[model samples]
Target: MSKPKSIQVFEYSTLICGQEYNGHHFKKAHFNALVKLNEIHKGNYFTIGVNKITFKNYVGVLQVDGLVIEILPKIDQYESDSESSKIKWQAALIEMLRVTKRLKIKEKDEASVATQSKHLLDIYFEWFLAEVQKLIHQGLIKQYYKETSQVKALKGKLEFAGHIAKNVVHKERFYATHQVYDKDHLLHQVLFCALEIIASLTKGSYLYSTCKKVQLDFPEVKTIKVSAKTFEQIPHDRKTAPYETALAIARIIILNFAPNVKTGSENMLALLFDMNVLWEQYILVRLQRAQEKKGFTIIGQNSKPFWQNIAIRPDIVLSKGENENYIIDTKWKNIDQSKPSTQDLRQMYVYNEYWNSKKAMLLYPTNAISSEINEKDFVAFQETPNVKDHHQCSLGKISIFKEGRLDEEIGNTILKWFETSKNE
Candidate 1:
């Protein structure tokens, strides 16, 4: 089997006609698949132009037909299409996901993912395979499920209507509804379908053989068509709790899969995520981990009612010693410290006011080309003529990568900034 062609492009970058990027040709078929995908997704992922397709803030892998497009996050310093930069940013994105708990990588597989030169899709496929293998080793759970069928002998309760309708002439057959305890339930059904998809998509890749082996180990399950709602209808209990991670990954694979009935080769699978949400969660998780040791309490998406049936929430709120509260709003974009957006400033101001925080800071990720400004304070606004209370806001920069790796001490840095400002 021939390997599917792959292309690596940065988020918000454009792919034009006649462009061969990273040794992969941006062919017309690939473009057509993309257009069809955009139409299916209502143009949320990227915008299609006459001869070019420009990506949006989403960063992940999208495979259409025989082509795979891996979208890496764009850091200002690594704006160019350099192989080293691609590897760095790709690792950074995966690390962020792992930290945020979006991708669950076991400690044993961490080294494997780090050492291998797999694309994002392959990494995801391997993760799914690992989870399935673990479940198979530990044993897939069995549950009592209702099954209605025609049996030779009497079983559970008999459905008189079904019995009469189907077995009028055939008196030997009895139609009944029975409760059977088995591993062939909805959860395994979903996982089985996802494994089939992985088997098809990972062909000619390093994970193809392992995926096939895992599929062979999985129990035979009834093949049923599932939609997004089908996953939502799944019930969670002690028995189903262990399958959470596997089910989550399965949901991503099964839901995003779109098969082209006409040609069968233009099948599409997109696993894209909004970089903004990921950044916010990444920052929140890091801050909570770092501040837990201290006496500070960190809350994410802390919301309060602003109006009738409306609320205002900040990305993060840090409270220490009960009297001091600090607001942090994370932005994924790079901006001049001196020229923060008016809308953002107003939003921060509102957060400070509603949350009763003295200091509200707009936190941004810093890169090589970003401004030197670390934490620049915005002028304080007086509450009223008779009141002595004042509200202050600042624009702060946090370095996302340290020595080409994710900076795990970012929360400590922010804590230091708050302490220093308090002393002054």
Candidate 2:
């Protein structure tokens, strides 16, 4: 069998069948699979049009049978389709995920993989395999599980009813419930299930051999059906803590995997994430790490009741000393010269009043291809006639990339901006 055809598109881009897109056609099977996948996700990943599928804010790789759709982030809309642009955004997305603890990759392993040209999904597969290998090297943990079966020599408690029912014909066998201690338990079962999935999806990829080798080392545990709730119910302690990272990745792969069993041609696996939520998380993590040394407290999604049974939460709240507080809300989109939306402004205003913050700002990522809006001064709301104090909001932009690499100093840069604005 030949290798699957792969195509790349940025988030919010459209793909249609026939010769509409660079002579590449989107097969009806693939489109149908995406539609079904969207249905499974409640239509959050993409929107289906007449004959085309337009991706939404979610960015990641989606595999539908023989077609792999690599959806890159449209951080810089101008050069979104360029090869270099895709690599840059891919690296940025992966780095952000690492910082946010979504993807667990050590610094040395990440440095080695950073130089290679690989799809985001493949990179994830490799990372998961690496983690599983580590666990295997350290030895899989074992636990006691109950098993019920017929045995020639009864070693455990015999099931009287079952023995009477089954062994009535075969008097030599005993039906018994026994406790077996081994590596074939829930944790390993989940890992094995995910490995089966990876084996099916990663054919012809470079990571296939490594994945298969890892599977050989892994115990052949009983396969069990798992859901999001199944993962949530998994108990963690010193014995099972090492399985956390591998199990997390397995949950992602197993939950998103949609197998078309009838025809076996429409199977799809979607590992997409919302860029908006990612931006918020990335900002929070960066600020938390950077502000720790500055003697400032950074809180994320701090919520307060707004009205009856309603609450409001700002993205980030910076607190220093006793009475100084600042609010920063990160937006994933780029707003060049346009004024911040009235709804956002009003939200920030409320955040200030409720949090008793001295200042608030709408933080945005600067366009990678161009400089951001020049305004740095805060725009104050119209004060009431006799009010003793007023609140202010500003449009803040932080450069996302510097010299073709992710700017690690973004947190410090934002902190500098806050200090400068406060002094003025």
Candidate 3:
């Protein structure tokens, strides 16, 4: 007897439609993968709307019972019909992470070589774990607590409420209040939460040993379930500086983590991110840095009045002095090869009108067709297509893409764009 050809294992980066996933291997893994994805999304690092799409194809970065499957993205207006686009997905993801300021880059982490590996998902997970470990080595931050519990012997003070009733006969129960070492503390809980999730997700000995060591140090501490509200309860001070890095990583992990519902089932987590938000943040951070260097201010998510008592928020606004400003809205989608989208142009028109500026930009990710906008100038205007007469503002598409030097290239591009304001 031999294995059936139809029962082949799904390879890494494999693409399949929802209809084709009715087989045994996919069926067994489907529910669990969805569960893990939902769990991982709790961290707020990214979001996955698995329930939103019913019959469409998905690009896979899924794991189920040691089986990995990736769904390829469908062809789009800016995308080529070739299969190589799926291979380049890892590069796109790495590029996005490269611009993020929250995740510190380490030379030894080998992030530069992510393009060569199909296991990018695992690599990111390992990177996160390593960062957490490094922060832990700086000595885990601790907080004082006024702990009160019943003990066999005296510790702090006797609780009259409990000791009077329970110890009325033998007087054995002792209610005590004393600061004791335990895990419910936020710092220890963060480590414990990460340890638990990492223990289930990876089998690496280093991470496992680190987790065990943390458990030993905080022997009484337990995993404290965290949420957005949990962060609000945590206070920041001098002792918490080292915890900042670990706290950021911990928040991401804890937010995305989902415990297994059934006994012995695999846990779930999601790494899906909103490309729109990521792109906006990247542009905002770089633009702010550029503006600050030139003694200017960059305000993000600037809101303005619209018709019908409505309001609109432009993504990024660069200002020199109080009144003179430039508006830029970043779109994560690909640009139209011939011209910018009418809707995008109209949106910028509103931004320009509200800001009382003659120029506005609709920024998009780089496509196959490169625009003439360079890092030194960063702006090139085109006449609005439908504007037969006086156009409200000059609308243009600025490409923000990854090049050799991301930070320097992007910073220069932003600075150059703002420089045009001097002529206006």
Alpha-carbon TM-score of each model against the true structure = 0.92, 0.92, 0.72
- What is the alpha-carbon lDDT for the whole of candidate 1? 0.82
Instruction: Encode model 3's per-residue lDDT on 286-366: one tens digit a residue.
Output: 777676667778788988667689889889877777777667887665446456677887787777767866556676656
Q: Cα lDDT of model 2 overall? A: 0.80
**Model 1 TM-score (2 dp):** 0.92
Q: Across residues 1-424, which tens digit of lDDT does each residue of candidate 2 receive?
A: 3445678788888888543343347777677778777887889988999878999899878777656788877655665486677677777777888888877666565545436545667777877898899998988888988899999998889999989999888999999999999999889999998888888887887767888899888888887888888898788998998998899899999988877521254467788889999999999888888997777899999898889999999999999898999999988886865678989999999998999986898988876442232225766777868877788888887778888767887887788777777666
Total backbone collisions, model 3: 16
User: Root-mean-square deviation of each candidate, in angstroms?
Assistant: 2.6, 2.6, 6.7
The sequence of per-residue lDDT tens digits that candidate 1 reaches over residues 238-335 is 98898998999999898888775212455678889899999999999988988977667999987898899998899999999868998999988876
lDDT rank, highest first?
1, 2, 3
The local distance difference test score of each candidate is 0.82, 0.80, 0.55
Cα-based lDDT at residue 83, candidate 2: 65
Model 1 collision count = 0
